[model samples]
Target: MLSGCVLAGWLVSGLPALAAFKLCNQSYDVLNIAIAQPGPEQAAADDFVTRGWWRVAPNQCATLVREPLKTRFLYVFATDVFGKEALSGAIPLCVGTRRFVIERQGDCLLRGFLDARFLEVDTTDQSDWTVFVSPRPS
Candidate 1:
């Protein structure tokens, strides 16, 4: 009987560590961010596969691991009044509710809250985005 109680205590203590969560909010309004890594997990080490994991309205407080369909890994975009291409000059990058694009890949949960953003991406293919995070900007 004492062993059973001790075992329960150990299990309860580990629950806190497993319940941790996080969000990634770059701006006040919602913004889409895709943490992508080129290559396929199923493919062999010698080969490569281009894939992306995306999330709509990824907040600074986001840390929960979502499924493949829930998150994306491709080019996730946020638009102002200009639409998805609003990233052309940064001037139109308004804040507020906006549309979202999602792409599924092996239970969407691309990596985690990366500590950085400035990356030298070869391209920004806005093809994987289908889900609209919002209607439009005000």
Candidate 2:
């Protein structure tokens, strides 16, 4: 039989690492953050859902998704504290000026909303992922 200490060590080593999705702000100015991930009810009728508005202060970090990541892809959008665009990408995603959860991406103006470029992050199906938001270089 294995000793108590040996058994404990083995068990600990066999356990999986903590899984989470986190955002880190590495800029001087405060940032307004948003995220989009897979949504429930993926029936033929209902489709993917995306939500946002997680504010992150300068030199801070926020946990966007506390549980283990369920999707391989994630979308992100962020702006400065002054409502000026800070970071964006070519991928277009439906977003609002205020806190919102869009069911799908399309026709922002018709839906009474604005369009924002959401950067896509590929997590490679990892259980944990962290995204760092940095200011544009002068």
Candidate 3:
């Protein structure tokens, strides 16, 4: 099963707003989650807006994107408390040694970031979306 929570609000009073994108942790173990999307302002020049280290307890959820889902592609990298990576696949992205929000990806060494494997998620051009982190069957 998957559990998630979403929040939406306006930047100004008396104005409609966009729904947020959420990530739900359906797995039994707690997860440290990372999210990447296009930068709000800088993405026109940069490629991505990367943020990480959102701790999601089991059966709970976290808001990854607080604004309306603008991009079709989202990236995620997750790990458990014991340092076990909680994702599959070999798609690599730039990550930092600690919690970070990098303006872009690529040139990890020259840019002083670590390379991590992020699974790609296609949102299908929805205004809002949820990623359910289900348990890995044993």
**Which model, 1 or 2, shows the larger TM-score?**
2
Candidate 3 least-lDDT 10 residues: 1-10
Off by over 4 Å in 1: 1-15, 19-23, 41-60, 63-138
Worst 10 residues of 1 by lDDT: 1-10
- Measured with C-alpha atoms, the lDDT of residue 81 in candidate 1 is 29
The model with the greater TM-score, 1 or 3, is: 3
Ranking of candidates on lDDT, top first: 3, 2, 1
Q: List residue ranges in candidate 2 displaced over 4 A.
A: 1-17, 40-47
TM-score of each: 0.26, 0.77, 0.77
lDDT of each residue in 1-138, candidate 3, tens digit only: 222222222234475645777878878888888877766674354477778889999889788888777778777888788867886345667777678988767777788887778777777777777777887655
Model 3 lDDT at residue 116:
76
- Candidate 2 lDDT (Cα, whole model)? 0.69
Instruction: Name the TM-score of candidate 2.
Output: 0.77
Candidate number with greatest lDDT: 3
Looking at candidate 2, the ten consecutive residues that score lowest on lDDT are: 1-10
Candidate 3: count of backbone clashes, pairs at least 3 residues apart or interchain: 0
